[model samples]
Target: MMKIKRKSLFTVFLLSMFILSIVPMSAENVEIYSMEKLLDMYIENSHDIEIMELEYELTELKYQIESDDLDNKERQMTRDKDDFYDTKDNSSSQKNIDEKRDEYYASAKAYAASTKDLMIQEFEIKNQDKYVANDTAKKKNSFKNDLWQLYELDKQLEVLNATSDLYKSKYEVAQLSYSLENMTESDLNQALIDYEQMVLNSDTLINNLDMLKGNVYINLGIEPEGEPQFDIVPPQSISPVNITYNDLLSSHKSNSLDYEKQSYSLEAEKVYFDILAGVFLENSDDYQENLNNYKKVQLDFYNYEKELDQMVLDVYYNYQKTIDDYNYAKDTVELAQRQYNEAETAFEVGQISALDMDGAKLQLLNAELTYDQSLISCAKATDEIALLMDGISIK
Candidate 1:
């Protein structure tokens, strides 16, 4: 007889699944959903985001109407000034012309700024959509992880129950042998120890299961109407998309609302300068301040593009790392599966202890869980890339 040291069941608590440990419960047995469908559900009834969308729409409309009104006023002022000079005050028409030009320039600047603000509001609305989509992606990723753990743990617990049942049988046999003076005291004590260890491991698995149930509910965002039923299918193969990282970065640059907003800002600033060119004194503080603001906006726009470029590069490298990690995890699962097949055969032939068989099952379970975890990581990478590219789907 050999004494086997018990391994730590607590190690499972340190995995990615634990990120879901603190969430509130949601509705039970929700049908399985993809990343796209989950985002749709979150957007449909999400009041917090709805408010943001509405605010952006209202602001856009308000600013657009104001800008149009200002444009009309500037045009009308020129017309009125022209008619006044042509009909009534021809002698002092030059003064009227300069005054009206100044007024028109001021109105043009106001219209330009207000139009830029409308573009900003449109960008804000797009950002609101991105926020809703990104949060949904993260929560779904978390739920996917929790489900994978639950699946592996559920299998592990089932196998562990068998081990416990066998241990109990051995303990009973040991007790009878001790009563009959056929087994040593040390042997009986070891049997009892094995039985207790199996029981404790079972208890640990059950507690972890309960913790996962609560987290799944919270990620889904609905109160548990009843016992939540999870129907998760882990990935079997890596899905490859027909695009490259440069393609992704290029798409991101093209669709970026931030860039669009910056363009509008720069355009409006140019109009502001054009309007102020004849109106402002060359050496005045107001002229210098306006010039500085233009330069600052230009610099800020360039800095933003630099930041975006860096972000795209970083994400691409990380995505590659996740791909490598997933392949390694997949290989680990294959090795664990082979070991488990051997252990299972040995157990069936009565050549191995129930504890040894259970240990093999646990190893396989852990490997499967790791494989699923890598899949989740890949999913997150895909989601982040999609977010950056503004709706480019990654397989």
Candidate 2:
């Protein structure tokens, strides 16, 4: 009986140890997304990343083919050189030596070009890695901006609802006054029209909000129980870290995936051109044709570099205008706030109708919404330039 009791205690101890060891493995899944987690998912699962992976694999296969070809050519050249030494016919022996020497030189050049091709592929893989990282960051930042705008739409809906309610209530009062002959027929008709317009506007806004919410859900790859809520912290300032155009151009030129791809194309052309030039006379049609093609490719690459510089320039100027707009929107918000306060005072003192005060409130809401939009625009532009220049996620 003592042995049985000890066995039971040992069993319990073993079970307890197993449970403690595996507890962390049973952790719950995350239901809410932070920006960092979202960026991680995008980087891992994006179609562009998948495509880059496939391209890298294809490049490796091509490199292997070239390497194998070079190895086989070296073996053939070795056989020809041995035969050249062994052959009894003098002319035949000299011809064999010259042919083997030409093959050896050509094979050496081919191997060198293939080695550079592998290096180009390695560089491409790194550039593509940066591209995926930058693109994921850009997408996440855009999603955040959309979320902010979605939240603002919630406020806009509330304003529309309030306006609709006030209009309906006022129209009811105006209808009674018209029945008692205290209001003109035209005034009552106008009240009905205003109430009808408010209802129509409310319906339209609700539809729009539904569509926008769907857009957010589609981008996030998640289903929401109801309208999803965002926890947005207002920006302390809309301005981004200072970046000069020269600094931007330098980073972009060195790190740009597009530019790097173009560079690799130009390098590949040069490799092929070198091979062709080695086999043909400079005056031959094939050599001249290839030389012209090489020149054209070099020109195109040069032009594309300038275009990339201009792209950076454009992003900077656009960001500047967005900041200006944000500043202007702030001034408009303050003006609207003052006007609403004055209108509220006028309504309280019986100097303006309730409808007039509601109009002022609507104006304030619109100004605030516009100001919010400008802030988001400024933030998005800043994020875009950062993606182009730094390739780092916002979080």
After TM-score superposition, what is the CA distance of residue 341 in candidate 1 from its true location, in Å? 2.3
Candidate 1 lDDT over residue span 1-395, tens digit each: 10111122212111121222222134253333443343344445446556756776786677677766766756754665465445445555677666665665465456546555655555565577664554544444444445556656665676688778778888988999999999999999999999999999999998888678676555446566556544344444554434577897898778765566667767766766655554456878657767887788789888977877778888777778888999999899999999999999999999998767767877786787778768767655655665566632222
lDDT of 2 by residue, 1-395 (tens): 00000011112111110100101112274243344444455445457657866876786687677666766755654664455444524555666666655655455445546655666766665566566556555565555566566656767887888888788988998999999999999999999999999999989988887788777555645455544443343343554547888887777667666666778878887876776576545797756877898899899988987777778888878888888898999999999999999999999999998878888988898898788778767766766666667523232
Candidate 1: list runs displaced more than 4 Å. Answer: 1-40, 68-112, 118-223, 346-352, 387-395
TM per model? Answer: 0.60, 0.69
Best by lDDT: 2
- Top-TM-score structure, candidate number: 2
**What lDDT score belongs to each candidate, Candidate 1 first?**
0.63, 0.65
Q: Give Cα distance to truth, residue 4, candidate 1, Å.
A: 38
